[model samples]
Target chain A: MPSSATSNTNGHATSHTKALAKPTVNQTPNAWSFFAVPRPIKRIFDRFPLLTYPANRLPERVQRVKSADGHALFIWCAPEDASENRASFNPACLRWQAFLKSQNLQFHTVSSSNHASTNERLPFLVVNPSCSSPFKSNIVSAHELAKWAVDQKDSWPVELELHYEPYMSLLNNEIRRAWQYHMYLSPNFEAFTAPSYIHSQTNSSVVRITSSWELQKAAREDLMKSSPRIDVEGLYASADRAFFALDNLLKRKRRMVADVSAPSLLEATLFSYLFLLLELPLDRWLDNRLPEIARKYPELVELENTLKKQYGLQPPAIYDALTGTKDSTLNSRTRLEKHFGIR
Target chain B: MTSRLNLKIWPSGDGFPFPSLNVDCLAAIAYFQLLWRTTDNAVNWTIISDWDASQSPNGQFPVLSCSCEKEIAGILNIFQHVGSCDSINGHSDLNSWMNEDELADCTAWSSHVLTLGTQLLDLYLFITYENYYSTTRPAYTAFLPLYANYTIPPAHQKAAEKRTEHLGLATILGEIDDEPRMQPISLRTGGVDPSASASASFTEKIGFGNRKEILSKAQKRMRLESIVARFLEPLEELLGKKRYFLSNKSPSSLDALVLAYLSLILEVKVPDRWAAEIVENSKLTDWIKREAPHIYGNAPNKG
Candidate 1:
């Protein structure tokens, strides 16, 4: 029996241990060690494989599956249609899916909402054991997922890497501000993004409204990090400047190179932002700005189309449903088919 | 009928008995000690340094569990609870020094100290990586098992980061997510030594990858200094040459609160000396020393 002193009110033994034991600054405990079997325990299991009933039951080369619900890599991403072709409507989730696709990694995507994730953020990846290893099964979300990808040797080229930080900052800061303003701060947040994304997740209208409010507040706070207050026109102008620089870079690269089929990490980052920005059903004033900006630079549109074709991503059907031009139910079914690769 | 009152606080380091590394824990202790000194209530307090805050009423430390099965968490709430019970009687009414206007002044100052003062302390102790890893975190994790020493500090640090973020200071300091990888000598340096001449030359060597990082860090440092200055201005002005804040005769709960923070700030050896410098430059250190015997039995000669 486990020690009673180790039992926390939350019923999590780990927390109880955390409360009892003091942490030192010397060494951070290996996260993998938490899942590693002790030498003695491993010996006991090795001596009698039958006694290790679960271990004996696991299929060959699928060692990680039995440890935690049987999978090499389990991704909790936003709901996608049947063929799993169209990227997630959530920009963050779409970014992860695109990143994974770019890396040519095979993984299972579990359709989940933000609430399902450990950090209440979507596009979390759970890495399971492929074979016996000291590293435990790890669940990485947000930027940590990107870090994990880098650890796996899926990194940008040196030229792209040099520009990666500033570009990422640009995306996370300026481009993100514009995208968030369009999605949440703008009028379309309530009419489109909130209802389709946030409202569908929860039953309570209060939660939907409050969650939207909170998200918008967070976006505003993020914007305010650079400046004391929000400047709508200034934000759009800064966003336009960022787009122009990116457009010029892509245009120059396209013109200079004979065959530039390989997508840069910069392109992936830009596509993540633009894909969401272009596909979302925003109010006319907010919606027209991005397309107008994109129309000025054919390179951006070409890149978007290339990414869409590469990923087999379909046009988001939520737009037609929101506009009341098509039956939402039928649109959703077709989307599901397209996403899941159904007949 | 006398009710039993049990005060649970985070344990102090071996040498530092009454003065806990945590400002909140120290404040809670100071509040309780003030109650004991002025009131007829018999309080039995336990120093449970490894106490699980999640088990408390408010998911924080310094919980006051009364015989009535009422568990009050947070220093202010516990103080209010004790006051409302009429446990603090006779000379214990420190508020008697203030007239209506003075009382309002006292309360305003108290609120300011609680909010801005606490934020300043949070920045000094937790938000800054050096102070956190070196002093605050080690003190809390000192008595715990080896495994726990690794897990608990990060958890507490994460919470502190969140608290600072909510207060909007995290933006100026850069998000916790953006904190540099913990360097072995980081705690030793105490978060970019203000006096270090090396930082000037170091910026040149930052390379292309970390150019943005270096710039933001400098920006954060400047903003933090301004914020610290802002928090100090009111306190410095209010306590100018006064025997105690808002009262000439005796120390009030406001005094206790301020002293709790001041004493902790003065005592802890952190990288940012702004708070310590403020305490040294003002009469607050003298006041803390003067009130030390009443709070800690005997005033500690050294921090």
Candidate 2:
């Protein structure tokens, strides 16, 4: 999911002009000016407890950027075949849509054919800054769009949710091969519904650069700040909400552990098991860092509280309760099994 | 009133007999029965197979039925009257019940298998109808141009002469002689081998190389049986020790299709050496014996 906020560059024009005149401040960081200086993301790092680790400590493969309103934009893509069954909106696209819907974003669906026709004439607008759109515009040519996004970064705070459909159809052509390579550079562009056939292109399931407090800090320093902050809490809360839907749909009310259904018990069972496996560790990460993260970005605290109350997740307290030492009294013995509707 | 269904499958007298009533139609019958059961046994359905030898009804399939209708339209009308239910996708109330992802998964699986099977049928048609083969040994020369003419006239004649050494001409080819001047070659008449050729054995067993090769080759060709094991292994693991695979719940359409295909493959007997070895293998033989009987039953029509 890409972040909804982008930076409005129009603000601080006088300060930018003054900084432009000063050669010291204007000096390029190596050849790429963007690479040299730490953006507003630096302050975002200082906001979280464990996440405040130095910017260089993070993995280079994961790129974090901001939307126009200074919201973090995290994007990824999944390439798949042109089969008729999945022609309109495939499983990967549906999953992304479901995720977006869960986040309470106002979404729009446009055909790649329509986008290709009008993209050059129209400037892509970041509509519904409050994350109201359930969907982002799915641009056809991701590489060109990514390059265009980087070029237009100075002009507007708009983020590109680049669609990877064009490259998929060109698998036979050798000359236009490095579309995926170009895709890696666009920090905000995401590919969706990636086919199993395209797995060889990248060694990842689907690239998702989780926009954390660091990216927000980058926007705070380098981009224009806006009022009302644009539903930052909703972004995080939506993820848990989607999980809650799955819970209601799949799990028996009493078991707290989800078992597979007869038609697809194997797939469902594995999916449920994997979700729990990922959630336990994630809950811990959120719990330990909530206080400091709450202080810096108050929305994060509210998001954390929502997750804790709704999902029965408390990273730090649960960790203490499970440790079961003489010093601990949390009584977290309520088996995680009960949560999945298992006996 | 008990509605009687009179099914007439297409291609009239000589097409692959509507899988039912054919010597080996049990698997197809089981499939139809399961299809009915999956739909809550709603429709009193009859399948009519039209053989190729049957008369064409003025560039249309011949169909006759009651219910104040005529032709294919009449048959369908009769079906509707008997079943009183629209097809699966056409049912409105059923669509609401099917919106659940569990039902969606079954539909998806069925569609996936149907697509794959349909493509394979297309390939089979292409091969059987278009490909050339040896007239003497149809089994030995499928999809291969075994009867193709050689360039040189004398060489082609010489090659044709040696073709007879390949197999017993009468048994390998049809017993009927095409050339009126040539006498009929009778080896086996009425399942009894003649005294002269009785001492002689069939050296070529269709696809097998030689009589001596059956043992070593049977051991080597044991891998084909692994497919049956592979198919059943997933059912056991995913389905667990339960009757159905999805959850320990009632079987859905997905289970029915898979169970039918498994029985068909198990029951499909071919005299090819590889197929024989596959049937002879204890693991596959035992698995087939256990699973096939449970899914299907002793010849329903025969009783």
Tell me, by TM-score, which candidate is best: 1
Candidate 1 CAPRI level = incorrect
Model 2 segments more than 4 A misplaced: A1-343, B6-28, B31-47, B51-233, B243-256, B269-287, B291-303
TM-scores for the candidates? 0.42, 0.28
Model 1's number of clashes is: 22
Instruction: Give the per-residue lDDT of model 1 (tens digit) for B52-168.
Output: 555765455677776667777656556545655544233334455455445434444555566566677777777766566656776766765677778766766665565468456
| lDDT for each residue of candidate 2 in A98-145, tens digit (9 for 90 to 100) | 223223333332222222234332112233345434565533232243
Q: For candidate 1, lDDT tens digit of each residue in A125-210?
A: 76755532566546777768667667776465333322334445456555776777777777666545665566555667678678
* Model 1 chain B: lowest-lDDT 10 consecutive positions: B85-94
Candidate 2 DockQ vs. native:
0.00
Q: Looking at every candidate separately, what fraction of the true A–B Cα contacts under 8 Å does it contain?
A: 0.00, 0.00
Give the per-residue Cα lDDT of candidate 2 at A21. Answer: 39
Judge candidate 1 at residue A209 and give its lDDT.
70
